[model samples]
Target: MGESDATIVSMILAGDPRGLNRFLSRYGHMLAEYIRALTGDDNDLFSAVYEDVLVDILKQLRVLAGTHETPEIKKLSGKGELLRPIFESAARTVRRRFPDLLKASEEPKASPLPVDDLAAFANSIDHVDFKTLLEGLAGPERELLVLRYRLGFDYAEISNIIREARVQLEERLVNARHHFRARLFASQQKAMV
Candidate 1:
C-alpha cells in the first residue's frame, strides 16, 4: 500500500522484470526471516521451501501482468486484490513444502538477511523481541506472527494464507504476546534475584 510498493506493483504489471526483482528484493528479507522462523537451522529445508515460494510468486507474476494486451491492473491501487492471492498462495506453498520444520528444530538460522533497505529491517529482529518465546508456540502461531510482523501483512491477508478466522488469528497473536511478555518478566525477576 505504500508508495514504493505501489510503484513496484506497477512495474511488475508493466512487464518490468527489474521492477519485479526490486519488489521481491524489498520483501526478501522478511520472507527469509519468516521462513527461518519456521525452519530454524534446517537450511536445506528452508532453501528448498524458500525457492519453491519464490517460484510460485514468479508464476503468479503472470496474474499481476493484468493480461498481456491491456495491462490496466497496473494502474489500480497497489494493495489490489490480486496481490493478496499471490502472497497467500506463496505462503501456502511454503507451508505445504515444509510442514513440520518449526516443531522439530532448534533456533532457525536464516540465510543472510537481504541488504535491500537494511535500514527498514535493521530493528526488525530486536523490535519483535519475542523470538525465544516463539520457540514454544505451535507452528501455525509462529507462522502467523512471522506473516503479520515480519512480512508486514494484515490479519485478512494472513487469514488467506493460513485459512484461519480473523478473530481466531488475532486471539492467537494476543496470547503469544502475553505469553512472551510473561516469560520476559519472569526472566527479569530471576536476574534481579
Candidate 2:
C-alpha cells in the first residue's frame, strides 16, 4: 500500500531474504493476533501454528515469484487443505511443552471487552471470538470472517487467500458479519455484570 510495503513486496518477489524479515517485523504482530484468535486462546498453540503458517508462506513465496506476483496478492477460495492440522499439532505441542497450561489456557469464552469501552473494544478482542464462534458457522464462513475483519483483508485480498471469486467472498463476508454480530452481541450481554 505504502512505499515501504511496495518495496518489501518487491524485495520478497526478488528473492531477498531481508524482505521476508522486514515484512515479518512489520506485519507479524497483526498476523500473530489473527492466528492467536483463530487458534483460540492457546498462546503456545498460536506460536506453533504460526510457525507452520510461516513455513507455508515461505514455501509459497517461490510459487508467488514464479508467477510474478507480489506480497499484496490474494488467493481464491477452497485453494488448499484446511489448516486445522496446524492448530491441532500446535495444541499437541502445547500439551507436550506444558501439560498444566492446557487446562488453564483454555480458549476464552467470549470477546474480552465492555461494549462502551471503545479503546478496550478495539484492543481487547482477539481470534478467540471467531474460533469459539466457528462452531456456529461453516468452515468457509469462519475463515471469511477472520480474513476480512480480524486480518484486515479486503474482499479482494480475502479472495486471494481463499481462492474464491470476490463476489462470493463478499457474500461470505456478509454472512460472517451477520453471524458474528449475533455472537458478539451475546458475548457483550454475558460480559455485562
Name the best candidate (by TM-score): 1
Worst lDDT 10-window in candidate 2: 76-85
Local error of candidate 2 at residue 154 (angstroms): 2.1
Q: Write down the TM-score for model 2.
A: 0.50
Clashes of 2: 13
Model 1 lDDT tens row, 40-106: 6678978887888877876666665556444445454554344566567667786676666534333
- Residue 2's lDDT within candidate 1 is 52
RMSD of 1: 9.8
Compared with the true structure, what per-residue lDDT tens digits does model 2 show for residues 3-27? Answer: 3544555577777888778767766
Please estimate how well model 1 matches the true structure, expressed as its whole-model Cα lDDT. 0.64
lDDT of 1 at 93: 84
